[model samples]
Target: MFSVSIKASSIPMSEREPIQSSMQISRTTGQGGEACLLLTGSCTLSALGRRMGDLSDELASYASDPNLHWDLTKIDQMDDVGAVLLWRSWGGSRPEYLSIRPDQERLFSRLGKAPPLPSLPAREPLWIAVRIGGGAILLWEHLTSIVILAGQLLLDMKYLIAHPARIPWREISANLFRTGAQALGITALVGFLIGVVLSYLSSKQLQMFGADIFIINILGMSIIRELGPMLAAILVAGRSGSSMTAQLGVMRVNEELDALTVMGIPHSLRLVLPKVIGLGIAMPLVVMWTSAIALMGGMVVAELQLGLSYQFFLHNLPDAVPLANLWLGLSKGVVCGMIIALIACHFGLRIKSDTESLGIGTTNSVVTAITVVIIIDAIFAVIFSDVGIR
Candidate 1:
């Protein structure tokens, strides 16, 4: 096969082709002493090319003279682009002194009837203050809702205490199995891996200082007093809290929440209270289990890296971390667990009957629960700083 070669032009776009432009404009004095703006040659897009801006500017200058005669009839071949340029130059209306052909007259008429473009509104000066106020109002609304729910729970709690038969033991048990029992495997794995990493890192620092035995104290105090509860709470917030919110959101979509309302069953009594009580009971046990698993992992790592025996690590654990620390960790679990459940239910109950609301509500529930858990942890750290650190 023989190939036909076509060499491309080496000339730059801005530098080439404008030299042979056909469209031209010139000013001439008319017989009546008025200036005549004459346009000639092919007044189309292909002909104008890079010289369009220059032509538009010259046309506008001639248009400014109200007494000037625009003679576009001289144009040899005019298209839509040429018509638009002429129309715009004449200030969206025909010049007082003008001459045009029938086809060109139609183009001007169409352009005259076309609507003007929409413009953007001016921005407000106090937009920042408005945004801040809106956010503060939303926060206050959420806080108020949460406080109302807590008070309702307290009243229901008193009622249940007096009439033990109406207690939602079955619902609480079901939630306990879901939030606590089903969560163990993942929590154990996470705790063990965390312990191993902490032990490995701490071993290096202790070994350098000739204080390898201090690994037990570091792991024991930190894991039992802080890390264990916080880790479990965060995991549960993302997992079970999201599940709870989504469950309620789905119920709202399916009209089950409405059905329950019509059937004389309160949402708090049947739904929210059980989840709160279940998580409250289950959280401490989970914290304890997590702490134990992490300690076991740390013990294994300490023995492997520092030549410390597992028996020695276990034996000195009680003396290294006080019993009060374990209790404090469990207490944090209880508070965080209830707070997570409350946040989840609050978001869930507010979900509208739509898939978009369901998705947004579930996401907000998990995020708010996790954030509230961290905040609770920080508060506990500050308040009980002197209680567990010894």
Candidate 2:
């Protein structure tokens, strides 16, 4: 059997005023050679009166013992703080041989039932199959939305055909100016540079064989049939497609589209149909203008580098390049314009009610329009490889 005693500096109830109280802690050996702590006097904030450093240190030494017991029968008064101190000394749980009055037992019971502190959520890595499946689902959702938008536009077109007066001619003209007329300067500038570079390079190779006159054939066929339509389409996709998406996205964010719906305005007819038709009408004209300007540039380079007269270049250009190639390029222009407008409207309608969504929708609209244009151009090349080539 062993023993340890701790005395506090507080005045005991009997030694001072009746309201004054003090605490004391003592240790003893229990049955079966276990260690025990006996808590006596008032075990409360006001009663303990001073910090129980000595008592806590005395108890801490026996913390590693598995058979430690606490006897709380002699506690005359206790509050939450006092209960918490003793509860912590017992490793936050009751010991096997604890002895406490019914009132003190209730204090410890409430502490034990308190909700635990919150912890951070665990981060788990996703399986490879789950990631791939999720991506496939998202791709399907986007494709379905695009198809629905196209069907709505088609229905609106039929309605307009029956009711010609309800057609939005004013909107169509405005979009034509924005998407096509405004883009002419950049398209012409790029086309002229492309023509000059192609002529210069072709002159170098044709001159080696003393066949400099064939620069007209190579330059006319390449620019009118392929480069002209492609340049116009790509420029429109970057400049005008992104604008359409941003405009619709802002309308969605501001709830303007909802207001239009409430006012009995069909969104597809008012917003999407005019833009598509306008671009379709304007794109062919842009292609023709770009091709004309590029041919003039090629003629200038041929006159300067190949010592070929402008008159000879012009007179032979029509005979050297077939008319079918010109028609093919204009046809590509009309199709590409409708495609760009459709892709823009598709992403625009998907924007959420936030500025971040507006930016993301615009970026996606431009990228997807350009990608579709290249894919379609490739398909056109493969299918018409024999038709336009001489």
Candidate 3:
């Protein structure tokens, strides 16, 4: 005979019982006869409390058996909760050979009753629609503010032109130097790489067609007509536009703008005009620098890969790209810079008296500037295509 035994300790009546209780199980097997379970003492609420581990161990021993015979003959006391725990441990469904003492029949009956399950509330389609509609309204309001600001900028152009002296020259110069000169090194490196890539790619395709010499024309046209203006504008917009929005937003939140107005000072002339003029002057110069560096990069690539002389590359550049193309790039840079400054100022002025509004204004400036740049580029593309510039 093989047997295992476990004993549970008594729990206190005055104090609350622990969440789990211990139990002892004695198993006996004799001469290969069906294994027998001897469950003793009370695994009850008042006695053993909740002895889940003991019950689980007892059930696990009989898991591989085809038929389990439980001997509850010596149980002094049992409760409905204990009966339910046993029933759950034994695979839930009633076994055909379950043996319960006559005294514990009431406990078994209670365990058979099912507890009420929680009910889930039904979802309402109207509530979902209302939330979606509210979000749409908020988006529309933001878009409307952007449109009104653009309209106001257009109407103020005549006023700006007439009062050119009202623009703060010193502040404009400071901002131009900060936004343009500080970015020169990185812009030159990026422009150089772009030029090198264009030269190498064009050289390969041109060599295949026996037109390798025209690689200069390809680099010149691509840089002067498109890459130089677009790249410089994007870099300035990302750097200067965010800074302008953040600066104005801080002023708006701290009530400095209001204070300036109360002191009879023109906030627009002091703040907005300087930024607009600064960017307008700086952007074209940045574009010119970017174009020069890009051409140098292309010249280096041409010399290394296409066996072309640096002097030859420089000599062919003027004929390959016209002065008209350089002018077009400069005009694009000016327009893009004005758009970035205008959008940044407009969003900044819209900030509320909170940090959240400041963040929103800064983000809105970048998005608006980039969108305007793309739209203007598309317009230029259509115009240039019609004129047969390519």
Candidate 4:
């Protein structure tokens, strides 16, 4: 009898290991006078996936023969993975001439009757209306909380006014000193630099029109009426407001706020009101201080750039910018400071009891305070436009 050779080299070199699990396929005469594929050896999940290429590479040679058959009588072992692989090779159906044991036939018949794999659900498109509605709900909640906090603060203030002895003067004093005295240096430096730059730029433009004297008016009106208070508010928001929020948040994390409540202490009156009243009292003074320093800075630049005397600048400043503008700026400081303190305390109280909450509360307090300050400044500009214009 002549023997035919089957080579593992027929598969890719990556699967050429002689010791690995493998399959043998050979062309042989079938019962109906056609060539068919002979599958033999152990066909199982353990080896079928790794030896897939060895069988798939030669499957096409006997596929078109009308009498093609599967002779699996020599298969020592079989599994679902091997059964499915052979089923697919036969165009996902059983061959009429399949010669196998009762168990293998039952396995192929069960696999054929199994339902198709479920398809994945399609993805849905995003809806803008849902997103907008959710955002609106969140914004409404925040605004309502702020309004309620403001009302509580007003009630506390009215009570303090009626009973002065019950007020927490010591806490107020400490916060004032911390937020005001400690902040003076940076506020002065920033105000001075701003004034100098404003004067320098104004001198260049005014000199073109022989309007050098008007630089005093420009610098005075801009600094005292707008820049001074806005600058001070922003600086304090970033510095003092963040600290307040962090302090309260830390207290919350440590459960000191709850302890205070247990001892019959009102957190709003002791913690929140003190900060609010302190900042409201200190802010106007800080604004005036910043404005004076900035004006001095403007005077120095004027003297050097336009040969304008300090006396002329001082004398003209009062006439150029009215006392009403100074009052407007001071009022802005009071409103802005109260808002900042309240907002800081509000966020601080909302903090979750954790280190991450402390940091997030402080950052949110600073950002919200600064944004509110600018928005209030704009509203003041619109309402009092005719009052402060020189």
Candidate 5:
């Protein structure tokens, strides 16, 4: 029989004492060359519990010992807190050599076993056609609402015509100033640059054929028939239409429109009518101003690059571009203005009692206004295309 040798080293008391205690292993030799261990002291539940390194060291030292046995016989306390260490150290087998008392089993069970992890759900692809179909339905509903509003406007036309004097001139003037005056600078600048670019492009091709003298024809037809009215309408739609929608939407949220109705005042006359009239009046003027500036810009380009005289450019502009072109541009402006004003008022009246609705209505007004403008322009394009005007 091999005699058991005891080598005990007393550890100093410190913050990590409880953890160190679990690491302390007692080696003993028993009958028939049996080697055993006594696992003692603190684990996870203890105030200054066992260190992970302590468990690792124990597992490593026991790994090479195929016939090693452990004994918990002298363990005054035990826990599942060290169950993982024991199970792993014993090659994932229960430590059969170490007998756990009944009371020790109850405490070990309380530490709980690890649970299985959950699996992730798979992703599905989106059906884009269905989403677009739903959007189309929503767009149809919006258009139906606009048609109903138009009918209401038509029904109230008699009342409006009878009481033209009751129209809010002050409000109309203010909206006109905003829609027209404020947009003039930007519209003019854009128109001028467009005219310069058009003249330059046409000059490039015309110079090859010695027709650079006809640059005025390109500038006049392009600006008056298309660019002038389109640019002006778009600018007003974005600026004034958005403002009108947001303003009326705020008023609707605050119940001011209702209050006016209760006070025996007309909501349409006080709000919608003024904006509509103002936009109608201002749009043609803005288009005229834009067209004039564009022509001037084209004249400068023609003189500098194409070597055409300012007098020749101006003289030929009227013949090359008829007054009908100006009228057509003005007509487009008037129609665009009415569409923008109507859309803004319609969205404004539909606003809910929230700031978000005001924002939505304002955005809707600009988008709807621009869409209507383009559609109307397309119609005009088809109508004018047969007249032999470029």
Candidate 6:
């Protein structure tokens, strides 16, 4: 009994408590002879953290040696994730020489018995067709949801009108600050840069044709009528839209959305309405600000490149761009702002209670909002094509 105790005590430390030790790999014999790659310590997901990739790579490298034994008998803790990871590293088969605990052996046995994932057809020609059909179905579903949301928002508007005291004033004000005030810096910088580039490129072209004065027409008509509202809507769709989706998604994740519903609070009346109205009111102002800053940038560049005066640019601007154009741009702003808010809220309210869904919903909201904004702009351009132009 004393000799047996001494021999047991002489055994490798890795054969002891894996809970207290970090996982590692070591060879049981010299490199030139037959070797065994002994795995030790905890093999659970919580233990692996970020080192799974590196460990997988090392395992794969050692797996190339057909004669090497994979010794997992010393491992004391392992979950399915770690085991599956090993199964994949071994190319879906056990190593030629493996030493494993009975419990661990059961895990690999189950993995081996599990049905393989259904494979795709070989070089299917209808793959793109299938994808397009799926996208169309998704788009139709989104459109239906959006229309329902819009109708609900309209009803909410009626409800608020009848019960003025129930209006979400604080929510609207908060959204105004978030979607409008916080967005000014980026809009200003992008607008100014766009103006400078437009002016520089136009000046060079106009100089060749001896039509330097036309720069004012180009800058004023394009910036005021098209670029201003477009830039503002795109930026808001990406920034404020994504933010709204994420906010609602997080609320859903935290079960706050469910709580509100239980309290007899409708999302459209309280949450969605505020964002729509706030952004609707704020969008025109943002568009006006972006247009003004951009024109200033253009004016500066025009003065330097074409010897044009700021006063001259400002004076000709009124004649070059009609009042109708400014109003048209503002109308676009209102529509875009409301639509962006609606799309964001629609996507947000539909988000499943998961981090993965939250991320996916936010991304889809931004992309869909931007695409819809562009579509709206195009429709406006077609219907009001002659309204703003000379």
Clashes of each: 0, 0, 5, 0, 0, 0
Tens digits of per-residue lDDT, candidate 2, 225-312, equal: 9989998899899988999999999999999999999999988999999889999999988888888888888889999998999989
Q: Cα lDDT of all candidates, in order?
A: 0.88, 0.85, 0.77, 0.85, 0.76, 0.90
lDDT of 3 by residue, 244-357 (tens): 999999998899999999998666667876788788888898999998899888888888888999888888888888778888888999988877887788888888989988
Question: Where does model 4 exceed 4 Å of error?
Answer: 1-131
Stretches > 4 Å off in candidate 6: 1-133
What pairs collide in candidate 2?
none
What would the TM-score be for candidate 1 when compared with the true structure? 0.69
Worst 10 residues of 3 by lDDT: 1-10
> Residue 268 CA error for candidate 5 (Å)?
2.3
Off by over 4 Å in 1: 1-127
RMSD, candidate 4, Å = 10.5
**Model 4: pairs clashing at backbone N, Cα or C within 3 Å:** none
- Name the best candidate (by TM-score): 6
Sort every candidate by lDDT, greatest first.
6, 1, 2, 4, 3, 5
Give the C-alpha lDDT of model 2. Answer: 0.85
| Residue-by-residue lDDT tens digits, candidate 1, 78-179 | 678988988887778888988987667777888888888878876678989988998999899999999999999998899899999999999999999999
RMSD of each candidate?
A: 10.3, 12.0, 11.6, 10.5, 11.8, 7.5
| Model 3 misplaced regions, further than 4 Å | 1-165, 386-390
Number of the top candidate by lDDT? 6
TM-scores for every candidate against the unseen true structure:
0.69, 0.69, 0.63, 0.68, 0.65, 0.73
Per-residue lDDT tens digits for candidate 5, residues 295-345, read 888888888887899889888888898788888999889888878888999
lDDT of 4 by residue, 290-315 (tens): 99999989999999999999998898
